[model samples]
Target chain A: MSELVKVVVDAMGGDYAPQEPVKAAVEAVTERKDIQVILTGPEDEVHAQLAKYPDYPKDRIQVVPATEVIQTAEPPVMAIQKKKDSSLVVGLKMVKRQEADAFVSCGSTGAILVGGQVLVGRLKGVERPPLAPLIPTEKGVSLLIDCGATVDARSSHLVQFAKMGSIYMENVVGIKNPKVAIVNIGAEEEKGNALVKETFPLLKACPGINFIGSIEARDIPSGYADVVVCEAFVGNVILKLYEGLAGTLMKKIKGGLMSSFRSKLGALLIKPALKKTLKSFDVTEHGGAPLLGLKGLVVKCHGSARSIEIKNGIFQCVQFKQQRINEKIGEHILEMADTSKE
Target chain B: MSELVKVVVDAMGGDYAPQEPVKAAVEAVTERKDIQVILTGPEDEVHAQLAKYPDYPKDRIQVVPATEVIQTAEPPVMAIQKKKDSSLVVGLKMVKRQEADAFVSCGSTGAILVGGQVLVGRLKGVERPPLAPLIPTEKGVSLLIDCGATVDARSSHLVQFAKMGSIYMENVVGIKNPKVAIVNIGAEEEKGNALVKETFPLLKACPGINFIGSIEARDIPSGYADVVVCEAFVGNVILKLYEGLAGTLMKKIKGGLMSSFRSKLGALLIKPALKKTLKSFDVTEHGGAPLLGLKGLVVKCHGSARSIEIKNGIFQCVQFKQQRINEKIGEHILEMADTSKE
Candidate 1:
């Protein structure tokens, strides 16, 4: 491994693309001495964006040239297969070759998920790789595993997700034996469908994690669980609903606040406090979803990621590396197997 | 068939039973001339509660004796089977025997769902009876079908839910050719789990209903579709999240508003207009969930339902009767079969 932690970023990927990624890389490298960033994109555009930041430290960030770009609308697996010279492909190749400690992208989720599994590969003993994202809750942010990957997922995959997610939360995120709960329609153990019902008992029996009983989707936003578990379909629904409903309610609240003259004045006064409180409930600023149970670290940020989110995504790789999260996860999986044998 | 649209209510059910349901019965009789209520519970207890309302039209609200009560913790199917004289069972029997046009309960959802199907029975050719609830949306209240009834549901069942929900929305909720959408993780036709993938084409070809394609959970609060279709698991998660997150946000906003004196003054000015807007998003104040596709209507209100929700639930049955909703639904199902055959 390199002395300085190296993170490969898809500079041509998000909606803001080269500009945001370029700015984030400069900020990340400038802010930390033990980290380096490799920007993968067309040489000219990436260099032009980097040149705009004249005062930024130039030595810590590198630019790698790629010939093609993956458009958002293109088929994900096909795009990854066809555009081997694209920024996403080049970045993944860097991680696979161990030239980069981790890869960060604000590209197509489908492409990232497909390429991560096909190229970087899964960890030994892992049946499937899960995409785990951190969601802002009332207490703090909670990690939701299998949010988009592994649709029609079986109970065994859910068991692995719990173990991998628990490891990440404990070692990297630094939560102490994080409280894990399976998402069910009701809190009762017997209340879920076939998948949840079968997984509930296995999760309870999981070793080395704080396993709480089943939790309903309603209780999620209240910070009731440190790690919320579900298959891809249920997890995706919860994630999207959390985003959509929170957004609509915030808009409605703002509109309500602006309806009258007195309310507008009040809105002005409470603006700072409201922003602070809401920031605690907004997790997108924290970082991106990590494709866990993989051989190497891979983080997928939102397609619309800006500088803060992109920078945060790059920074999380330092923790993953310094904490040796992947090695610990491999050890945990073996430990779980040994425990099950007993 | 009766001169008035008669609804039997379980007076001993709910968290505030014998009080809220009793008061709601009185209110319903006073509000509408074409409706009557039958209170089924312990004769003396129900009568003493009704005596508190001295000026109520006593003749329009009748009392029927029931000796037992089904607690929320009892096994639903077994409770409906064993509790022959319990308020829930007796109330359902009244509808089964054609003495009442419908039955309303604020009791255990399992018991209500069990008794609604086992006792009141399904309309001819109805495969599954679904619990459909009106959720407050930005545009208006939208009906979410099978919100908790049919867990582990099949694709064919989803197709039927779409048809049934569309009919109810058109006739009862007064939406014309209501747009039906199956709940999905993504809007793309090919993107979803096994159930939605199978149900999409079936709903698209369904007769006598307007079928839109897939809808993401995030788009739900915007009222993108009049009838949101899903099995109980997805629907329940959506409903509970909608309630829990919305409640949490409102509390957080109120806390923010009350943080300072200036905001407090602003709160007073925006109170009425805010109240009006928020009320449009509060579906509980409107009514309860209806166990549709039953021979006779059976509505399950919230356990904490008070006078207003109970009164509205009783009132909604009048429209179910006058519009001949069940008959219309039966016709629609037959038409779908004929279309499939062709």
Candidate 2:
């Protein structure tokens, strides 16, 4: 039998709470013998939810009772520190103690980010851990790093993000080399604000990574680069705007198609093909965002995530473990340091 | 007859060059007797292009000879200083001398921005001029201020932007008490970078403007705020991404519809309705970006602009001149100072 990849699931997090997490855990363990899941939440509630899946592999799934549930509205730092027995904190602790290879949550973004950093801790020589999410593009998917964690990141931090992002894309996403590009307002090296101006040359000169030149936000959807790097504020704006505009446009298109009987008939004929095409662009199918550069992998799924997203996120962790992504990142950082010295 | 709003057209500009500019100028003159257009370029070329439209309103259109042309790749400051006889520089100089009420260009963005500030100059007490472009939204449109200008702007500069954006939206776009918003990664006041945190309170306290709280980029396309304000970098990302993602999606939709015979038939039936719905989101159907806070109005159309965009840009300048936008901005600046003192 193959070795099991142990992943801790926060059963009481997200909008759907213990129901979605418990179902996802059962589905994950039932589908794969090479994986084990430890669900952390109130034991009675988790067991009740898990009871629905009678055919789940009882030997692979375990429950670690966590009595407290962290709400999404609480302050992130304080919640992580105070709610020691909360599902989110307890699950992160399991990762910290090496009891689990990875942790997955669909809780408040702030709480998860804080818990990932303070509890899981950063890898040695990693300047900052970036939350890199796979955004849907025309060519497939591209990783957008620093979507929320570090707002005022320095140039050195950006260089580290590039190295780590390249490793993630190459190993987990199965892309070779994975072209890295810095986000800028214009393509010219001298055309950006002070932060971008400072970072551009550093990224251009950095060794061990295939650093492409600046990419404007306009080219992102066309999949111009595999890994797009930017400060957290800009990255957040790009991610959110991408979601907002796509949603708005899709709704408008649907409204247009339903306005008249002729178009309505047309919509019926194209519904199946259109659904398949649009489903590829759905972000949830791509899985959760992984907080890279951590001692152990930590994935933050959307708060409104369903069972499908949670299942994908679990599978993502299995890949992370199988590919040894963290080990590769550690070695890359050491090599980068050596290159800087030479 | 109403007074003629004289607008200077940069004939030696954009991808289509003298032909499109000359044609647009002729069309503008023919469409309205209340407007006159002065074409600036090599006299022979301008006259030759104008000859294509022999039945155009000859009395309302005129030409001024310019011997040189500024390429888009040249350094903006250097081009504006050296290319005195270039069509762009000559047209700007005309605005500076009050020979025309406004200047319209499909030239280099950098050169136009530099020339507008250096030649026509900022209004009294105006800190920095912003490039305000009307972006099409689900509900009409919203004005995105400082799209490519004023990077690394201060809190005070943002406050100024909100005030000016409010004025432009109210006067030109005719939105009453336009809801002004500062773009942020999160919707909370304390949930932004240093710049947004500092500016939020000031905007809330500042009188004479309708200052709404923070707006996430996701809400921008739904037209949540009439005036969406941000530093140039973030604003540029939002603007460009909006265009890029929309274009990519539309192409993908078309490709999907053509993939099969049933879908193809559906596409044919829905063609007219979808075309009308999609046309409302077209950026060109709106006008050029107006460089606000200038003593004389200057509108910069897209570099790839055609006759339709140029004609709309000409009419945009007429509105600015008719509404006395510059004079209103001047008064707003003075009023802001009085409120600050209190």
Candidate 3:
């Protein structure tokens, strides 16, 4: 018989707080009987929210009281160091102490990033643990690695990012032998800045994953590559820009539809279809980005995440553990490093 | 009497080549008699394209014979050096020799960037010439500086980029005291990597423009700043991503609208309003990006530029000339530098 996968969720982390996280926890446990959840927050608040979900099995979910809360604006390192009893830190501690199989939070990105490393720690030989998100594209979605997880990265670090990204796409995403590409200004190898210039050749030579040549920012949405590797700075810019543009475009489209009566009628008729199409592009439909290379899984949902996203993030951990992604990643990277040395 | 602004159009550059450039030249001359265009390309081809436009004033529009074409793939420095008679080089040389006030091209961006600095020369105390493009935003448009022309930039170079961006926005775009922000992962000054961290305080204390704190990429489309400054690599990623996302989103919207009969009907009804709204986000409606800090203006239109875009780029030169933008930029940056040193 298989053991239950214990998932630790930060109930006080996101904008919606205990309501959404507690609801998502109930939804998760109800959906999968094999899953057990430990909700960390103010015990009374969590219990009250959980009581709202009457159908959730009473014994399957438990609450771990965390007395403190970290504001998203607070400095990350200081918060992580100071707030030991906060939901974010306590959840991460569950992963660190092996009380839970995985940890999920919608807290401050900086706090999650810092706590993931300081608490969950890194796998042996892992240089950096990148936050890799599955970004929707024309051909479906691609993995964007190192999105502000590690900045001012060297060529070797980027090569590792490509490998870890490839592992996530291949094993977890179920994309067989994902094609990896380094982001650059132009497709030509000589077109990038210092970091990309130095990393291009090394990526081209890195075996195991199918390493495509350079990918321009223009090519990213075309689904030109399954795994797009970049330094945290570049990746962060791309991610933020992607979110910003999608939102503005959506808002404009709605405004356009409301400009006239005829268009308003049309908008009503097509609302469902348009909503569905736009939903495909929404990153929230997918789970939070996992801070890969950590000893135990540390997933960060969006700060504004609600129940659906929290639920998805929880399920993502189940899949990660089921596939034994960390073991595969550790092995794949170590083998690549050895071959490169040889 | 004000002298006419002579713009040397690379008649042989771009996908449509002499057809678009020549048509644009005729349109420019007809629209404003004070504008003159010198078309540089093969003598016969330029004349043949010009012949199609019989209404173009012979005095306002003239053809300068050039024998060669620099393929987009040709090495930039080598092409600018060896292909002296090529349309791009010949046109740049015309600017260098003061035969034209500006050079407009839809040719290889690399060649134009290289030739502009080498031939047109930099204004005194300009550390690096950045290609600044006015990108459409929610409020209006924001200037994105250092879009891949100069990379591996230092904090000093980024400060210069911010100053030049501010000058262009104020003197050319007609924004008074443009709000300038350095693009970073998060809004905090301490959030960015090495370059941004170093540049943040310097820009804050640098007097001239209205210096806002760091702007995340998500806030860019919301028109958070008039001038967005970054190192060339980060700036290039933001610019390219902006273009790519807009294109991809537009395509997806069209596809979604055509997915069903209801959506198709709605699309037909909303076509006019939607078209008008989307047109505002189109970068081509705005003029080409000027390689700022050069003696003579060099504007690079999109490589796939059509007649309308080519025409707008040609007229953009007239405003730059009338406003004496380069002098304003030189004075603004030099003044800021002096204050910072003190």
Q: State the DockQ of every prediction.
A: 0.61, 0.82, 0.80
What TM-score is obtained by chain A of candidate 1?
A: 0.97
- Per-candidate TM equals 0.96, 0.98, 0.98
Error of 1 at A189 (Å): 1.7
Model 2 steric clash pairs: none
How would you encode candidate 1's per-residue C-alpha lDDT over A134-194 as one tens digit per residue? 9987666789998999899998899988888888888778899798999898777878899
lDDT tens digits by residue: candidate 1, B189-303: 8888998899899888777779889889889888899999998998998998888887777677677778778667766766775676676677687799999999899999998
lDDT of 2 by residue, A1-342 (tens): 768999999999899988998889998988888999999999999999988987878999999999998998888999998999999999999999999999999998899889999999999889899999999999989999989999988999999999999999999999998999999988888899999999999888888789889999999999999999999999999988888898898888899888999999999988887887877887777889999999999999988899889989999999999999999999989888888888
The CAPRI classification for model 3 reads as high
Worst-scoring 10-residue span by lDDT in model 2 chain B: B276-285
Q: What is the docking quality class of candidate 1?
A: medium
Q: How many angstroms is residue B2 displaced in model 3 relative to the true structure, after the best TM-score fit?
A: 3.6
Q: Local error of candidate 1 at B300, Å?
A: 1.2
Best candidate, DockQ = 2
The i-RMS of candidate 3 is: 1.0
lDDT of 2 at A149: 91
Backbone-clash count (model 1): 0
lDDT against the true structure, per candidate, is 0.88, 0.92, 0.89
lDDT, residue A178, candidate 2: 93
C-alpha RMSD of each candidate structure in angstroms:
2.0, 1.2, 1.3
